[model samples]
Target: MSSLPPASFQTPRQIFAAFDRGDLSRESFREAMNEHALQLIEEMEEVHQNPVAAWMEHLRSRRAAGKLGREYGEAMVRELLVALSEVPEFPLARWIWNADRPHLPLYCFLRPKAEPVFRIQKIVCAPFVVMVRVEYGSSEKSATVREKFTFTRDQVGRLRMSGRERVK
Candidate 1:
């Protein structure tokens, strides 16, 4: 089992680390976060039903080619959703996706008091269709040598890793 939320019940959080400290109401924040998540769920359901968009189509093609498996894509979606949950501002998530994905799965670890920085080096990006980059490693330890993984948006419209990541 993974520390993942069921589709209907997402784990609530402070959700606004990027916001300047302010006097926003907790209830308001929760309401806004929930609403944002609901909208994403609605979008995901739509894509899951009709995966015609480029990303979704790409995922389907990779799975059919056996370069990416269904579970792999699902895992990426789950992990991306979990990471996105930590971000409250909707636009911020999109920004992170565009600018920080090269360092993603890395972004999943973003948390307050988490000042430690790590470097990820990408080695390859062409092997798996789900791969956003070819290879990457942190400063502490490199990933499995030549063992590759990826993150992609599933038909459900959730961002998921391409392969299994060990979770305790």
Candidate 2:
């Protein structure tokens, strides 16, 4: 189970004020953000199990070509991650930073290091430059990774249509 900060904790505005005033250490702010992220993950898991169950059901329906397209997008993201992991760290960061890419659709994997629980699914129309974060609860450790593979006009044109029109 993920542990969250107490409800009486400072709000984002308050935290930002402290940060701006140099009253809050950067490390403390980071830890707070990590905690907030874990809480969000917990909430998302709840929704995935219930309120969002309909979405999963829709994934099985006959009119799910959009979902199929999302699956393909996810496969592309996985391939990208695998390729990124192969590159040396510094060079990969430099390349990603310098690359002018547009946002592509994505699927994400969230695994809890302390537990056997994991979630994997597609995100529709997510920006390519968005941050990806991995958190380890036991050690209160986290890492973020971002990619810069935006789709060019020509690349968008090459995407498989699957009878359904591309989402604008």
Candidate 3:
């Protein structure tokens, strides 16, 4: 039998790195990431329904062990609640899990050694694309950093975050 959280949790980060290296095509990257995201959301829903399940216990242990970051448990609860109420702008857990690089600005849900507040520097809305410049946060190895998030409207006009890159 396979483990509850599946060792494939790190697959997205590897896929993203492959895309960065031009080893994977953009379409393939999007497809793989979206599939992985759907799987994670399904698991989150399952855990939400059965809070005391074994999978939940495994996740709790991971959080306590700092395998998933300090604020992961709280963030997961918040994400589940928001998901129950409405669709989120982006997959918060996915981003947080993949943000392992020292240079990358820490996700809002994470509490680094020194917590840095985020500010929305700019937002440009267009017909099909929306660009947001966010001052994300500082990490232990880096100073304050800004990131550009690109969201594109789908067929039904729901905006989905497609890309995140460090702002120069």
Candidate 4:
């Protein structure tokens, strides 16, 4: 039996396919669609305070604990810049900063000096950027690899992961 909670929601494709098939439960579909947005916004309030500063502090902490890999902080900040692209250039970022909203959740993996129980993986499609940093191996040996997945959010006013490209 796998320890990872069975993925709780349907994939974007699955939901819409079921919708087309006329077998979709509206409530289940809503909940399923909400899952990604919800996960992404888990700590959004905190990030909104000052996205740059908050990220800096987070990176600092990760570095202090020897969890962050080379340039991962810079990588995260760069990816963040892309994620908040338009909003930050205008006043929207400030608005979001002051708004009552949850903080964005980063799909980050922090490792101690130990072997990983399982590998982590996720797909994010963009103008939105999904940043991932992974450390694998054991206390005696390990390796860290970073990747950025870019996606363009569909503009039909629907929430979905539409396009994906492995940027590195």
Ranking by lDDT: 3, 4, 2, 1
The segments of candidate 2 whose C-alpha lies over 4 angstroms from its true place after superposition are: 1-5, 52-168
Candidate 1 residue lDDT tens string, 61-147: 344323222334434433443544333332223212332233443333221111121112222333233443221122123332122
Q: Is candidate 3 or candidate 4 better by TM-score?
A: 3
TM-score of each: 0.28, 0.28, 0.33, 0.28
Q: C-alpha displacement of 3 in model 3, angstroms?
A: 5.5
RMSD to the true structure for each prediction, in A, is 15.8, 15.8, 13.9, 12.5
Top candidate (lDDT): 3
Candidate 3, poorest ten consecutive residues by summed lDDT: 79-88
> Which of the two candidates, 2 or 3, achieves a greater lDDT against the reference?
3
Q: Write the per-residue lDDT of candidate 3 for residues 47-161, one digit (tens) a residue.
A: 6876676454554434433533343333332322222112223323343443334454323333322233233445555678766665534433356566777777678865667
In terms of TM-score, which candidate is strongest?
3
| 34-144: candidate 4 lDDT, tens digit per residue | 874574475466468668855665564455324222334434433333333222121112112211122433323322321221122332323444433222233333333
Span of 10 residues, lowest total lDDT, candidate 4: 88-97
Q: Is candidate 1 or candidate 3 better by lDDT?
A: 3
lDDT string, candidate 2, 27-132, tens digits: 9888765765675587568656675553543343323334434555545444433333222331222112211133432212223232222222333334332222
* True-structure lDDT of candidate 1: 0.37
RMSD of 4: 12.5
